[model samples]
Target: MVQRFTISLDAELAATLDGYMVKRGASNRSEAIRDLIRNALTLNHTDKSNNCVAVVSYVYDHHERQLGSRLIKHHHEHHDLAVSTLHVHIDHHHCLEMTVLRGPGEAVRRLAEATLAERGVQFGHVNLIPLKEHGGHHQHDDGANHVHQRPAL
Candidate 1:
């Protein structure tokens, strides 16, 4: 079911929304507003107990003493939270790393912060999306094959 509500916005705000709608390729104000609301709500989520998946990306100087080893050690310390990592050599001295993590929101955030706080880390960002609703899961005949239903929009 969908509920409708009316909102009042100043002319400047309305124009800004229109501009954003064009930039983001939204079909109309309704679609753009819905997306904006969803994004804002997701960002405001503060429940530490929530289960979530996150991508933590950072760029650093690989030449920094023991930085690589330290990052590895940190990941090892929280092995359960990490799903996988992709590393790229950006240049002679710099490397980019993106770690996919899944676990409690608190743990994921802590690990991301620790990794980003490393001495050589230059640019870092963590994007987290909570798994609020779990769709039904199914097991295949092989037992190794598992599938999950898609979340409803």
Candidate 2:
């Protein structure tokens, strides 16, 4: 199903939207608007969901005293919520890490906040997408059998 509608924006706002669409590589104004609406709605809905998957990213100085060990311990504290982690060496003194987390939304948010609150951590960000729990069996075209337990929005 699709819905068609019209909207009016002031000249300055319209021009700003156009520039944003171009910068975001949206290809068309309609698609850009749709993406913006979807993102806003998703953020609102995800906040109310009980379960979600999140990507937590942060940068820190590798030279910070015991920072790496503290981070590892923090992740260990929420081991069940952790899906995976990627570590990157940004430079001799800095490192960037992104961790994928899945579990209760509140727990995930708490862990992300605790990590970001640690001394020396900077540029921390967490993007969480709500997940819908489901129960079903699935079979792939390649004859692989699987179960559908969690679906993300």
Candidate 3:
């Protein structure tokens, strides 16, 4: 069921919201507002124990005194949480690494923080999306079973 409510916004704020709607490709103000509210609520209400997927990305100097080895060891230490990693050579001295992590929110956050805290890491960011398992597990025609996870709306 959907509920409707009315809100009053200042002219300036309304104009800003219009611009935001255009930039975000929202079809209407209601759609834009719904997306904004959902994002705010998700960020504020997520719990540490909730299952989530995160993308942790950072740039670092490859020559930073054993930093490459240390990063590999760190990921290995949390192997269960790591889903995949993409490494890019930014230049002769710098490299970009993006790792996809899935597990409890707390564990994902801790790994992201540890990676970003490395001495020469820079431009670090973590995008965490809380998820809920759907329909537990199901078997396919091939008899493979798996669980589906979707963002917690």
Candidate 4:
């Protein structure tokens, strides 16, 4: 069942939303609004699921008072979840790193929060995928018959 509601917006905000809808090729206002709400909910996590993968990207000062070292150490501490990391030197004073993590949703969320909370870190973004845990360890007659699932949903 679907419930309908009416929302009133000012002229400027409505125009801006309409512009976004037109630029993005969204089918309708409902679709665009649903996507925007989904994105906001994705970032504002509140679930404690154990089957999820998340990509945590952030920018920071690489030489900001041992921050880089701390970040590296943190990754090392959770090596199982640290799937891969991409580092880029944006400029003389800025560094960007995208870290892909897989494990419990809570663990990944905590790691992202911790990294983002560090001093000198900025513009942190995390994308999470919730997955169904079908008992990672499965038995099979053939070793190549098993298929793994993607991180986070």
Candidate 5:
């Protein structure tokens, strides 16, 4: 079901919204407004205990003392939260690492913070996506039970 409502925007704000819609390729005002609202809610609704999946990415000096070992230790410390990592050698001196993590929001954020705070780390960023777990377990045609998680939006 869809709910309909009326909103009033000033001329300046309405024009800006139209520009935004054009930049984002929104089909119409309603679509653009829906996307904006979803983004706002997602940003504000994530609490410490909320379940989330995050990607933490950064570039670091590969040869900086024991930076590599420390990075490994950080991941090991939060082994359960870490799903996978991709390492790319940017050059002889720098490497890029992107790690995917899933767990409680607080824990994921802490891990990303620690990793990004390391001495040699630079350009660190984390994208956290809140998730909602489907109620209980279900079985697919394969006869295996599993749980599903979808983006909170």
Candidate 6:
């Protein structure tokens, strides 16, 4: 069942939303508003611990003495949290790395911070998203569907 609640938008906010609706090719304001609300909910959910995946991006000087090894060790220390990592040779001196981590929000954020704080690292940022929760004690059932049933809006 859909519950109707009035949301009063000021003129400026309403105009900006209209522009977003046009640019994004949303069918109507209702759809756009629904999408925005869903996005907000997802972000809010992911911002909490125990339910987040993060992409941590940083730039560092690979030539820094032992920094590369230290970084590797750090990731290894949290091997359970890391999903994968992508490294790029941005230049002769600087390298760019993006590490994807899946774990509690705090742990992933800590890992990103520790890696970025190492000597010669710069531009570190972590973008996190909340995924489907898997906190139950269910065994691997190959045939059982595990889709979560969200409440009807």
Model 1, residue pairs in steric clash: none
Candidate with the larger lDDT of 3 and 4: 3
| TM-score, model 1 to reference | 0.80
Candidate 2 wrong stretches, greater than 4 Å: 44-49
Q: What's the residue-level lDDT of 140 in candidate 2?
A: 88
Q: How well is each residue in 1-153 modelled by candidate 2, as lDDT tens digits?
A: 999899999999999999999999999989999989877865554354578888999999989999999999998988998888899999999999999998888888888789889999977988877777775787789999988666645
Query: lDDT (CA) for every model shown?
Result: 0.88, 0.86, 0.87, 0.83, 0.88, 0.78
User: Please, what are the lDDT tens digits per residue for candidate 3 over residues 29-128?
Assistant: 9999998988887555347768888889999999999999999999999999988999999999999999999888888888988999989896798887
- TM-scores of all candidate predictions against the true structure: 0.80, 0.84, 0.80, 0.78, 0.76, 0.64
User: Is 2 or 5 the stronger prediction by TM-score?
Assistant: 2
Q: Least accurate stretch of 10 residues (summed lDDT) in model 2?
A: 41-50
The digit string of per-residue lDDT tens for model 5 on 9-34 reads: 99999999999999999999999999
Q: Candidate 2 at 19: error in angstroms?
A: 1.9
Residue-pair clashes per candidate: 0, 0, 0, 5, 0, 0
Error of 4 at 112 (Å): 0.5
Which parts of model 6 have CA positions greater than 4 angstroms off?
A: 1-15, 22-25, 30-49, 134-153
Lowest summed-lDDT stretch of 10 residues in model 3? 144-153
Write down the RMSD of candidate 1 (Cα, Å). 3.7
Model 4: per-residue Cα lDDT at residue 67: 92
Query: For residues 45-126, what per-residue lDDT tens digits would candidate 1 score against the true structure?
Result: 6578788888999999999999999999999999999889999999999999999988877888889899999999999988
For candidate 5, give the lDDT of residue 33: 100
Best-performing candidate as measured by TM-score: 2
